[model samples]
Target: MTFFLLRFIFACLLLPCLWTTASAEAVSFPELGSAVPGHGDVTYLDLARMVIPDLAADKDGFFRGSIPIEMRHIAGPDYDGSPPATSGLSSGDVLNIKAGGKDRLAMLLDLGDSPDSAEGYAVLALYDITGKPALLDAVNVAVDRSTYFRDPGKLSIGPGDDVIITTSTHFNSSQGYVIAPLVMVRNDRFELIDMIYTFDENLCTNRRTQNVAFQAIADSQLYAAIKVTVTDATVPGDESCDGQPPPEASSRDISVTYHWDKNASRYVKDSDALDRLADDNAKRF
Candidate 1:
């Protein structure tokens, strides 16, 4: 009897220790303040100012409805920016404008990179410009998915009214990206919704089963949404991305959706638009 009691006590003690160890390995929300590998010029200000998009809100639904990102650093600057930088389409850089494209505000936002998968920081900005027609209302983008190897930050921001961002990695899955999504949302008033990651993937192509995934958002009440996606676009057997990505314009594509439902009092995906979302919520440099 004493032996069994002692064994029980020992097992209890070991369990807690194991729990702590496992918990430590898990990643959480917004990897803000994380370094960008190099670029000493990038002060913490750069990191703090940076906004990475969570796959949950980017890869799919973004193109389904509502606002769309026109252009940014992704175009190398000339395509956007106040001064014009590079070829006008690098990969990940962002800007925002009013609804109709009247007010133009540009932020030199940064995108983080990762060696393991598509990586970078992303920041989204939006505005109301019912005056201009050749303009836009919001700008969303990703950054730094270069030939890297570390688990660089893969998150974005929805800074409220004119902004939105990534939830936490807790919303992500073990496949290297978020599966369900614990995204932070706001309008005039910003607040992190306290819901567990409970969504599903609707898009992903040319990758492993359950390994690659995508997400989308739609508003049944307002008729709007943002989408997100993830895929091992890197060359086959070359996970480091040190090699060229298969092709953004690939004929094959995969995607999913996430959206809000007035009747359900939550997000729902009555539709899907994977390819369009990839082009919209693009990664930044």
Candidate 2:
């Protein structure tokens, strides 16, 4: 009976150790590739390669090749199984910024199959001083043809250390490239706080169109120089035309300044100055 009692006690003691051993067994994630220690500091490229084992690296040790289609998040948000987009790390498709006194990384990902179309979404991932990563935000930006020919978009640090992202996309009515909605990272989140410059085709019968060009001007204050060009449709002398010879093509320039509203903890446009600029531009053209 004493031997049996000792055996029972020994088995009970071993139960906890067995449970601990099982618990300590490294978690196996087939999708994330081989298990590696100290994975907390993995960069975007590291994660990309894990998800896409066939990815190739460039001469500069950067991954610049396209991603496999099977690794994309096509239907829903399955971040564990597949990343939503792909990026060319060597082509300025990734941006690092500082916001709220923390390091933030953003990447423009290609979501479409057509290499000629810059149709993709964006992800802003935040990391701490220790390099622990977290997803700050994600957004779907309009595709721009220019991106296919060059880098996907431009990301910069705006006034008050805010993140500014610029992209170009096609507007059907505009019939040309128009600036996508300006995205700003404020309060650790992505916010579309500014209006985009677009063309209105209904104003004239000859299909007069307008296009806006923008540049970020940073000094003591954050400013954007927006140049708007209105192009009147040219009617052939032999073709029959409808309404009054469409208004003459004209161009207007405006400067918009942004201010950080402490109360809201976000950047707000200078309404009075914007109104004045709009009025002046309206009178000019």
Candidate 3:
């Protein structure tokens, strides 16, 4: 009888130790800051895995799974940020955004050789945190040194709007670029609008830099528009800009607008403004 009692006591002691060890293995939101593998003791990838239990990197360093098919469809065929088969898993950027009147986690996962920069490919992962962290949706976002998402900011189209805007920015030695995309929640899922607003300013060596201002105007209870006003100014070029090309004359200031078409489920692009911008890009950089 004494032997059985002692054995029971030993088993009880061992079980608590085992339980503690198991509990330590379970990850939570707070543990995202804990030690992982790369980038000091912890990495942004570790935070991603903590938030997304199914997302993991393989032995070869690539992600173990693919993004949801529905998100891919929403991104459309022309979207070039699709995950490559050869790109390995790397660090990412994490931020908070509002969706459904609650806080949601947004992660721009880097899927390129460059881990935490404006260069290389990336995938946007959104998670619903109303309860447990659950992946709401994900999509590939384009990234390049001259044109990539850098220090993305949050914006709302109108008062109490569920739409979120993400900015992509780059400084290509002589010019600065900003591209903002509208992400909205519709039909129980996140959707990417087909239109975008852009701003670019070049160095003063060859041409005058354009100063642009963006404003969100609520047209009505259900519709909104983005107003872009552009004015030109001659900025002095620094030593970094080696080419002292002939100065070009400045043109009159222009105002452009893009409207959200609810029926089309996307924002309608300003054709004239878009064509002019495209032509300038083709002719210049």
Whole-model lDDT, candidate 1? 0.28
Candidate 3 per-residue lDDT, tens place, 1-285, comes to 342253234334223212122232122222233443233644545446643435666775545434423335235655544343443333445555555556666766544423343444455677665544466677655434222222223445654344544444455555555444556765436677633434445554443554444466778635468665555455444434455554545555556777887787567756577447545654655
RMSD of candidate 1 to the truth, in angstroms, is 21.7
Tens digits of per-residue lDDT for model 2, 1-285 = 342253234334223212112222212112222322445455455544433445656676645544543422212343223233454443224544556556565544433334333444433333332354545455444333322111222333443353344444443432433344555665776666554443334434344333333344454433332222222232223233474454444544444545555577555665454455335334533
User: Which candidate has the highest lDDT of all?
Assistant: 3
| Per-candidate TM-score against the hidden true structure | 0.25, 0.45, 0.60
Estimate the lDDT of model 2.
0.40
Give the better candidate number (2 or 3) by lDDT: 3
lDDT of 3 at 148: 21
- In angstroms, the error of model 2 at 160 is 6.5
Error of 1 at 125 (Å): 7.3
Candidate with maximal TM-score: 3
